[model samples]
Target: MRVKVNALILISVFALSSCKTQVLPENTVQTDIKQVVNSADVVLVDVRIPEQYAEATAKDAVNIPLAELSNNIDSLKGKKVVVFCNKGIQADQAVEILKKKGVDVYDGTTWKNVKAIQEEK
Candidate 1:
């Protein structure tokens, strides 16, 4: 019937719209505290405001805060982007955004975790 056809169309549209790009695991991420500090081909982005990044950010961390993530997305295309925030909230949000946009992104999470991981090295 017409109603069934309409419902099928609606479901198809919903499924297509809800489709999300692939999300690589955090471990597969190439950018970490060690790679950031030791000088490598890493795309370490601080998803915080410029002020927060300038206050005391990781070495060689590029400032592409969450607010400007969408606009500056092109710069992240086809690259391994690792995002982080002060306490992991914003970074998690950023990871979702980047994944939807079909970017290869990793969650760097909190500074405490980054420091701890680095110390363990």
Candidate 2:
């Protein structure tokens, strides 16, 4: 019974941790990502799979799906990077990983929002 209780506790801990979203610290996120996008020094990344990116992605945005993100960290380390996935889930995951690696990154979350912001500029 004790073993079962310990296992249940472990599982619960894992579940809760996985559900937590990795967001930019309030100070780190800009009110509008366009400020970054419009800058010459920034990188706009689409974190969705290549197939999805091919369907449609913001102009000037590069594809770097989440699975392959870690391998490309060196190229992004010091750059201001704005990232987004379809609805933000994968983008959030990518942001968490990037932050851990000390990359200057922002989670733009939804592609729709990214596009809208760009169009307005």
Query: In terms of lDDT, which candidate is strongest?
Result: 2
Reference-based TM-score, model 2: 0.73
lDDT of 1 by residue, 32-66 (tens): 44564333565878888899888876656788889
- lDDT string, candidate 2, 45-112, tens digits: 99999999999998789999899999999999889899999999998999899988988888788788
Clashes of 2: 0
TM-score of each: 0.63, 0.73
Q: What is the C-alpha RMSD of each candidate to the true structure, in Å?
A: 7.5, 8.0
Model 1: how far residue 38 lies from native, Å: 7.1
Residue-pair clashes per candidate, as listed?
Answer: 0, 0
Residue 7 in model 2: shift from native, Å?
Answer: 35
